[model samples]
Every structure is written in C-alpha cells, then in structure tokens.
Target: MKKLFFAFMLCTATLSYAAEGTDTTSVMLGKNKVVIHNDSLGISVSIFDSEGHQWKKTREVNFVDGQEVEQVFVFSPFIPLRKNTKRTFYPHFPDFYYGANLLNANSNVVMRDTKSSEWGFSPCQIGLSLNKQNTLGLVSSLQFGFVHNHFNTSSVIKRVEEETCMLPLEEKDVTTSFLKYYYVKLPIMVEWQKRLGRRKIFAGGGLALEYRYKEVSKYRIDKQKHTVSRDLGINALGINAEAYVGFGSVNLYAHYALTPLFKKGINAMPFGVGIGITM
Candidate 1:
C-alpha cells in the first residue's frame, strides 16, 4: 500500500509539470485516463475510469517562495489497487472431529491386528487473515483429544523392561482389552479460501505438535475389570502432518503421524481419516 501511494504521488508530480505547457491535455496511466485542464484561474485535474466515467477531480493553489501559484492534483477515491481491503481475525480451528485410527508397519515387523480410533475437539482457536478479502490466512489452535487402541481379541498392552509389548490375555473369560491415550496438541496452518456462488470453500495443511500426557490400559474378564496407568515406553512428543478441504463450515481431513508411534523397537506409523466442523 505504501508503495502504491508513493507511485501515485510520483505520477501526480510528473503530471503537474506537464500541465504547465498545455491548456488542455490527457494522458493514460495504465487503464485510467487523466485529463488536465489549465485556465487563467488555476489548473484542474480529472480522472476517468476505463469506461470513461469521471470519478475524481481536484483543484489546487500552489505557493512558490513568496509568490502564490495555482495547481491541481486528482486522485481516485476508489483506487483499483485492492480497495476496501483490511486484515481481520476469525476462527480457524475445527470444533469437533472423529476419525478411525490405524497403524502401518514395516513388512519385516510382526504385529497383531487391532481396531484403533480417535476423537478430538479444539477448545480455543484463532486465525489472522493476511488480506482484506480473507482468502489467505494463518491459523493456530489448541486441541484436546484421545486415541483408543482396542485389541480385536483378548489381549492387553504391557511395558516390560523398556519396550511396550502386546501380550495375549491369560484369562479365558476376558472380553475386552484396550489402551487409551490423552493428549494436548498445538497446530499451525496456512489456509486459502475461495467463494463459489453463495458458498465458501477452503483448503489448508499444516504441522501439529502433540504432547501425550496420560496412558491407560484396561481389560475386562467376565465383568471383572483391571485397569493400569503408567509410562508404556511411548513417545511423549509427537509430530503430525494434517490436511483438510471443506465448504462452508464442514471439512474432511487426513492426519498422519510423521514421527514414530513408539519410542523404540516398534517401527509403526499411525494415520487417520476424519470429518470436522468449524465454529
């Protein structure tokens, strides 16, 4: 904007010099035509749009040393240079989303099949629009969530020595066994939005840093439940890559864990596909 204003002033000064030589003159600045009319009283400059509509006119009196001189400067009231644009703030985080979680393992690694799922919600979110149109922006938010790893059969997750390992349930009556993680995540993304008819659509992708604060393992043997809470050799800090596209307030997203799901031994990656809604 500053550059544009300077360019306008520079053009005005150059036009003022030219106005002294002619009683009536017209010059084209890009698409707009500037007309200068000089008479005995003073000089008046008029700016006409591409359609030849006159939108602005100005008359001026100049002072040189002790003598008074007349001059005129015309500027467009509605500059074609991104008129009526300003930076603004909005909400960018998804209010709620649920997804199915799965693990991808190396071909050489042997792991049991289990059903995993995750759900999360953003309690606080904010975005800063880079321009007046609000088409491009930066978003940051805090998400609190849980991931549950449920064993398909009678099995439980156990940490032995320094490795988290899966073990089959010794009790024949065991019906369910699962591991759950509670986490807080911080995500930052650059988003682009577009208007389609009356609907607005957006797409964004970014990195999220997550801290898994608590871990719980549980198993139920014929109504008898056993629960344990402890560090299970899992990675405390996790990095995730996420992308989403949506129209209006709803979006579909995919998330992939960039870092390993565990600290050591297990070479597995966790990923998910989900739908989210923004407030």
Candidate 2:
C-alpha cells in the first residue's frame, strides 16, 4: 500500500511540473476574443467570437533556461494587417476619379490656301484606378467641340459648298471664307501610371471615334455675311495615343491620333496638347 501511494504521488508531481511549463491567457480585442498559448516550442494565437473559433498563427521562438530568446506577436484576424500606421488611412483598393480636359487641337492635313487652328474641350471624363498600387487604369471621355479652318481661296470655298449641295457660294460674290466643323468625340483608353515625388506620369493609347455632325462655311463680301450648312460625310473613326504628367489635381497631357480624321481626300491626322483637372 505504501508503494502504491508513493507511485501515485510521483505521477501527480509530474503532471504539475508539465502544466507549470506552459502559460495561457485570453484577451478581448474589439468585438473579438483571442486566446494566446505559450509553450516550450512556440506560441500560438486563436481567435473566438460569435463567428466561432479559428486558429490564427503559431510563432516559434527559442528559450534558454525558461527565458525566451526572442519576442513574438499574437495577431488577431480582426485587426488590420498593415505594419505602418501612416498608411492605414490611404486607400488600398480600386477607386474612381472624374476629370475634365482642355486641349489645343490641330490636324495634319495640308489644305491649299487654307490656315487652320482648332481647339477641343471635354467636361466629362470618368476613370477608374484599378489598384492602390496606381499602376493601371481606364479612362473614358466625351468631347463636343469644333474645328475652324480659314481659306484664302474663293475657289476652294465654292468647291466645298457645291459638293455638299446644301450651300452654293457665287464665285464672284465671296471675298473671305472659313469652314467650321462641329464634332462629338468619344475615346476609351487603358493607361499605366507611376507616381514620382508629388507628380504622377502616365502613358496610354486607345481608340477614339468622332462624329462630325455639321459643317458650315461662312463667306463675307462687301461687309455682308452669307452662311451655308451641309453634311460633309466625314469619316468619324480614329485611334489615339496619349501621355500625361500630373501634379496634385492638375495634369498636362499630349495626344496623337494614329488614323486619319477623314476616310477620303485630305488625310488629316489630329494631335493635341491638353490640361486636365481631377476630382
């Protein structure tokens, strides 16, 4: 009986020593409850809440004579994963931005006895930044504007009016003539961007389709005005390439069309430099 009592006491002491070697604690983090367990080999963290229990992570740190050799963390899934608090307020995913563009537009076509200058503006541009990495995005815009071409030859002006058949200019009655081409343009592009010290630079190329709805020629002779409107049957499709550098909410950009502005005679390519404002 004494030997049996001695064996039972030894077993109880062994169990106590094993239990004393490990430590455990429970902590409340926000709405979640977390349990931390530290043993000879490692430390483990487990989370429990209304969602039930889940094991988060286990970290191994060596120990020498009951002293831990390194520090470790018990992370909770409910907490944010960012290591830098300064970056916690920044957006970490895709977002949308709206902007406007103002461009000085011109064409590559060389018209005889004509000097041309054109400008375009777009008040609506909707874009999406695909990631917080700010590397890729998409932009789509609608532009409504006009192109003004001044002609020095009355023969050229009369030719345009006679071809459209809507307006005919008398060859002897016209002194000065100019043509206005009104257009509605739509462009969609995929872009890549890089942020550089308060400035962001981007480059992209895409398809731009334009509709020239009305072409009007204005002729002046003897201080009298005459106007003729016609459907110019201009080709409305084009491809464009663009690049931009931005600072804060403002951007300066350049654009070049890869295709001609019109399908037939006088193959004119459109190119422009512009400014944009973002919100």
Candidate 3:
C-alpha cells in the first residue's frame, strides 16, 4: 500500500510539470489549434491543425542577432494591434452634369462712328459639364452652354421713294431698336476646391470659345412695325478669358472677350458677370 501511494504522487507531479513547462500556449478554434509563442523580439504564431501554416514577426530588434531590423510579415489573422494612420478618400464620378447660369451681359460695338454699349439680362444660359478627377484638391471640367445677347441701338433711318430719285422723302428717327445675337460657348477649366465644415469653396479660370450663329433686328418707327434681318459680317468665332470664385454649389463668374464681335467694321469687345449653379 505505501509503494502504490508513492507512485500515484509521482505521476501527479509529472502531469503538473508537463502542463506548466514553457510559455508556449495554444487555443482551440473549433477542431483547429492556434499555437502562439512569445520570443525576445516579438511573437511566433503557428496553426497546428493546418499543415505548413506558420510565420514569425520581429519587433524593433532581432531575437538571435540582437541587431535592429524592420517589422515585416504577411497580413494574417494574428497581427498585433497598431495605431492606424488617418487618410481621406474623395469620390469621383465620370458622368455629365447639367447646370445653368443667369448672366447680365454688357455688349459693346467697336466702331469709328458708334460708341454703343448694351447691358441686358440673359436668363437662359444652360449647358452640360463633364468632370474628371485630377489630383488632390484639383479637378478638370469641360463645359459648354448656349448663350444669348441683345443689343439696342437708337439711330436715324432715311427713307427714299422711287419717284424721289436719291432724295430723302422722309426721315424716321428710331428709338429702342433691338439686335439679338445667339451663340454657343465652350469653356475648359480646372478647378481647385477646398472643404470648410459642410461647405466647399472653389476658384478657377479658363479659356472660352464662342460661336455666333444668328442675328436679328426689330424696331418700330412712327407707330409702324418694321423688322430687318441681316447677317452681321461679324467674326463668328470668338475667344474669351474667364475667372470665377464661389462657395457651395453656386459661383459668380466674369468673362471678357479677347476677339472682336464682328469680323470687320465693328470691333466689339463683349464682357459679362454672372451667377451659376451646379447639380
């Protein structure tokens, strides 16, 4: 009986020594065992239930050589907790956007005998814009819009009949004569935008190309209606310089024409200031 009791105590001591042998430990995930071992530099992780699944990641110093080395390892489920760096990602859409602008156009005809400037409100400057993402805080856009301008000239008209033979039969002084010009303009610009709280501010400038397609003139002399339509042999193609500043989805812009309104006789430089909206 004394020999049997001594043998039982020795077996219990052996089992306790085996259970508390080393710092190497294991956890069970279902039927798989994930083993972890702490080293002098870092930790070694292994999966005993899966074949060939083991890796080691060193910290600031190497365990065996005691030299400084970078922490390198493949991404896995056993990564250490680290402070993540912050980053910002902006969303971009490669689609077309429709917008409109209400412009007060100041149009002037450049001629030797006439110094006429017309200021009118053009309400329907509508178009589409395509936007592309460039770099941070920068974006490129291609925009085109249909624009209209009206010019009113108050001048005199001399009437001569066939019987009068080059002599003026009557003189009509016209007031409030209307001249309308229609154009389709294209503007290419790069915008720099910044975010402040919930609002965004943007400022940009670009070149504009305008093509005039139609011109019409109408007036009333002595209570009688008279309309005259003629192709103002003006330069159909015009170039403009533009700049703008705005907040949110609204912007105020200014444009100055670098080319003449008419090809010959009239050297008109057109300019305007307007407000636009983007959706």
On lDDT, the candidate that comes out on top is: 1
Q: TM-score of every model?
A: 0.63, 0.47, 0.45
**Residue 78 lDDT in model 1?**
38
Which rank order by lDDT, best down to worst?
Answer: 1, 2, 3
Tens-digit lDDT string for candidate 2 (148-220): 6655434333225323212234567666666667677677777676667755555655666666656666767
Task: Give the runs in model 2 whose Cα sits over 4 Å from its true position.
Answer: 1-115, 130-132, 153-176, 196-199, 236-246, 256-263, 274-279
| Residue 264, model 3, lDDT | 49
How well does model 1 score by local distance difference test?
Answer: 0.71
Tens digits of per-residue lDDT, candidate 3, 151-212, equal 33343111223110111213357544544566656665555556666767777677878777
* Whole-model alpha-carbon lDDT for candidate 2: 0.51
Where is model 1 more than 4 Å wrong at Cα? 1-85, 89-91, 106-115, 131-133
The numbered model that scores best in TM-score is: 1
lDDT of each: 0.71, 0.51, 0.46
- Model 1 lDDT tens row, 110-192: 33344578899998977788877778888888999888776644556667767766766677877777777888988888888
**For model 3, what is the alpha-carbon lDDT of residue 192?**
59
Listed per model in order, the count of residue pairs whose N, CA or C atoms clash below 3 Å is: 2, 0, 4
- Model 1: weakest 10-residue lDDT segment is 76-85
lDDT of 3: 0.46
- Residue pairs with backbone overlap in model 2: none
